[model samples]
Target chain A: MNDTNSVVSIKDVKKAFGKNVVLDGINLEVSRGQVVVICGRSGSGKSTLLRCIDQLESIDSGEIRAAGHLMGFKEFNTKLVPLKDAAIAKQQRDIGMVFQNFNLFPHVSVLENIMLAPMKILKRKKSEVENEALALLERVGLPDKKNAYPRQLSGGQQQRIAIARALAMKPKLMLFDEPTSALDPEMISEVLDVMIDLSKAGMTMIVVTHEMGFARAAADRVILMHDAKIVEDAAPRDFFEKPRSEHTRLFLSKILQH
Target chain B: MSWSWPYFFDYMNNGLMLRGVWVTIWLSIISMTIGLGLGIFAALMKMYGNPAVRFISEFYIWLFRGTPILIQLVIIYTGLPQLGIRFNVIESCILGLALNEGAYLAEIIRSGIMSVDKGQEDASRAVGMNWRERMWLVILPQATRTIIPPLGNQFNGMLKTTSLCSVISMQELMRSAQMIAQIEFRVLEAYCIAALWYLLLVSIWGLIQTRIEAHYEKPFGSQEAVSNSEK
Candidate 1:
């Protein structure tokens, strides 16, 4: 899976927890500026795959490389060693992730939440991060929410702030894990609008969602996983219009019949 | 039961019981600070440290919490001399209080830390925060909300626990009351006065606890309402 152009290369990754295999022999490669949408049933390991890309969940055995560097290990003297937490933290700064729960820091104001990583981890100046955070707030269409606490905002607005928070780190790739699943039915499109906008701006993204409309409209490729394996990976049109596998066909019919 | 108002006034206005009250307050404050600090460290150790550290921390909590605070005070003050270790009374009192309180506080702190959602830490890690950074910036701040009310209750209990330190002859409020009772031979009256002081201190703490709870509650509740209406 090591290639010159691939931004993320996952080769034969396998992860399991206590005999419950979540990802079984998964292999994938994502290039820079590509938008990939992943859809699957609740237990299909789509979210785990996205989390594995960011090294949020440790892989059991196999390689997860982002930007040609191993995700959770450092090759030292020709031997791969698992990196320390602090070093992995520094390595992970290039990736941005958003969760279904919109886990914003509710204790601080939204501005502080956005500014914390840059100021603390990156050791950037306060005023500098402040200005950039304010700009990010504007970009997310939440200029006034700078002083607001996360719990004060609706789920849609909080998700936007969360996206802004991730963007503040200047990440090379974005991962969304069932981001809008917790929102109300009416609030889904607003968060999707933000993701669509992010896609249009050419941010590399791997999204795990149930939103088929988003997949059809925004995805370059749509990957469908079933029973811990990706059964279909194709262009959005082919996936929706001409899915090949029996599992993919059945899953599509069930999901799209609505 | 004859009561002397003048004698009681003398005990209060003069420095005897007043100084004792001061000693109790100072001891409780110092012990709580030390205990809370140790509790936080132990909680982190139990939650994230290597097996050796976790083992040591668990042993510390288990040893201290398993015994009575009174026995702990006695052992630290009297028993360690067999090992050629000697501590002054004040130091021994502090050690006993802090070690025992730290064990209980460690469990409280651990529970508070666990109450927060894992996604909060995941988000912190996503942004390149190390474990310490995630704790300082994300987990502890949220954990603090759930931690305070129980902490206040613990402190209130600590105030009463300090009475047990009286057996050590630490010149605290209860010790002073006992001394006065011995002198006047009016044990009931002296104890009643001690009871008043205890009631007064605990009542003050109850008020402060209410305020602290309200202080922490202020932002989260209002913020939710505001966020909802803003949408």
Candidate 2:
């Protein structure tokens, strides 16, 4: 399935731990340079699907291919060999993931947090990384907070810094897992605005969030997941206006109520 | 009679007592270093290692902590020789102190590492750092703030525990005083002088410890003192 058109593709992906099934026979295709937002109720395998894309969570069955690299167990002469942690990390570097909790390294300053990946993994020079980090911070409108610790920043600012930290790796695809779910209601817009800017800049992004307004306004394709499967996948206008699945419709109505 | 100032000064200047003080200082320093290194390793093993490693570390801590330090010292100094594992007086003293100190320090360090928020490790991994890098750069530095006060207390305890080495005839400060008292038949004067010397040394260490703690307390600064105005 060497389709150059799609940046990420999943075929019949299934993930389970013992008897607890998390993602069941999931199939997803993310096109190049398209912003896709995934929405689902809790335990719908939305975040799990995103994690599988980055190979943070391995799939039990099926194949995952991202940026032309095959995920899951690698085949070796009819035997399967799991990739080592370093190999998986190298693959994940191309797909930056922003966590729901704004997992900023609390010991580091905002600038160091952004510069760490490029400096350590990418092995860029300190001055070069610092300059790039400053530019990213400026773009996110937190250049003045370059030296502030994550604890010193508000939740919105921390998430924005997290976004900037991800961008420092210069990843081809960005994964955001409930990026604003932990933020205050008032502080959510600042993080959303930064993501909106990234979308406008044509960065390929897959965001798992309940922010229906963001899904409607910024997403090129909005996907609704239910029971470990993608129940509805369509353009934002169609998915929100005319959801076919009862689960999708019910989720929308509940989320869009207030 | 009240304390004699001239006699105290004369005792302080005695070569044997001065040498004993030096021995005590060096012994504490070496033992503390060994204890700290072992403590940190034990703590990490308890927290992050596999179950086998955790079990071994737990048993070590339990065995050392559950028993009395005096008994532990005796076991190291006296019992080991019975098994044909003989060490010199200083060596036995250091071994006893380090083992006992490591056990207590292990608990202190383990609690310190645990006190750090779990999010820090997750954050480090999210940034593409592997486990070793994450532990060294992120988790341990945050753990240092919590570990230091207890570590300081352990140091103080270890300093006093050096007196236990007198039983093994190590000729440390207490033993030196015993020897002098036996020769001069001045039990009160000799013991009083030894007490004053120990007090002097501990007081000096107290000052140094306060400075060390203060140094760590300052945020994002070099070791060089700028001015007293801020204080």
Candidate 3:
């Protein structure tokens, strides 16, 4: 299923934590401009799959490619060897990730948090980076909060700023690991609205969220994972209306009742 | 033989005592500065280095911290000279004190770095930071919040620890007091002046430490009700 147009391709990716296998034979392909939302139970390895794409969690075995490079390994004389930290870091730069907890640097202002990576990693001009950072804050609808600290912001505001921070690097692919999972009920839609706008702008994204509304509204393909495997992959309408897998039907019944 | 008020008052304001105070202050500042650098380097090595590098850091900490600073000072200043490694009194004092201080500070820094939330590292890594950038930009800045209070206490101890160097005839506060007591035979009076001066230095440092702690605690910005306003 991998193609030149695909931004992310995973082949038989597997991962484990000690004796607990997390991702088992997980294969997925996300094309450019595709918005794929992954839904699964808490221990279902949905988050691990997303994390493995950026090498935040190393896979046990498999080939996963994103942004035109292998995730954590390089082909050295036809043998797969793990890339060095600097090399892995360069690969990571092309991919952006937003965490469930937001993880905004509490010591810096919102503007600085957004500006840090582009200036330090990319070595862009400070003035130019500052202007771009300001524009990102504006895009996230928080221009006046440029100088505010992360602790001073609400949970929703911080997550938005986290997204803006990731966007500052201008990543080719963005991964959201339950981005709105930690937000207050009223704040969820605000963060999701920004995400919906991002998806509409043709950014390739893989979001691991239980917010089915997001799946219906923004996702081009909705994936259901269970027992460390992808059990369902279909358009939102078919996945919701005409479920195929026994796991999908069971997951939908459990999810939609909430 | 008596507690001479004249000798006590004279020693407190005398040129020799004043010079001793100056030496103690500069020695503490320079030694503490170098100790902090050594500490940070050692802590990073212990936490992240390969086995060989980590072993070096661990052994340095173990050797220095295992012995008394007084013994360490004597070895560096006196013992090393017989072995063809002769340093002047000031250099020996700094080298000995800094080496001892670094051992203690290394553990303090390691705990401080550990205290920072793990999410900070994850965020930094996701943003494409290498290990160096992650440390200097993200981890250490936050760790400074936890490191300052303990670091202040260490500095307070270091001010008095410099007195140990007096055994080597380095002529800091304690040595100056001993010299005056030897001639004037006002042992109690001269030593009391040195004690009071040490007290004064630590008290000044305490005030400065409070300001530093306050600065780090609110490093982001002032309280302006940004969160309150949002809700």
Q: How good is the docking of model 3, as DockQ? A: 0.60
Off by over 4 Å in 2: A17-20, A55-58, A67-72, A121-123, B1-3, B74-78, B81-84, B196-231
Per-prediction DockQ, in order? 0.62, 0.31, 0.60
Q: A91-167, model 3: which lDDT tens digit per residue?
A: 99999999999999998889999999999889999999999999998899999999788888889999999999999
Between 2 and 3, whose TM-score is larger?
3
**Model 2: clashing residue pairs?**
none
TM-score of chain B of each: 0.92, 0.89, 0.95
TM-scores of chain A across the candidates, in order, are 0.97, 0.96, 0.98
Candidate 1 vs candidate 2: the TM-score winner is 1
Interface Cα root-mean-square deviation for all models: 1.6, 4.9, 2.1
lDDT digits (tens) for residues B1-231 of candidate 2: 566666667676778787788888889989999998889889889988899999999999999899987787788878988999888777888888888788889888888889888767656655666667777777887788778887887777677789889888888888888887787566777788888888887788888888877665543343233223233
User: Which candidate achieves the best TM-score against the true structure?
Assistant: 3
RMSD of each: 2.6, 3.8, 2.1
TM-score of every model? Answer: 0.93, 0.88, 0.96
| Prediction-by-prediction clash tally | 1, 0, 0
Give lDDT: candidate 3, residue A149.
85
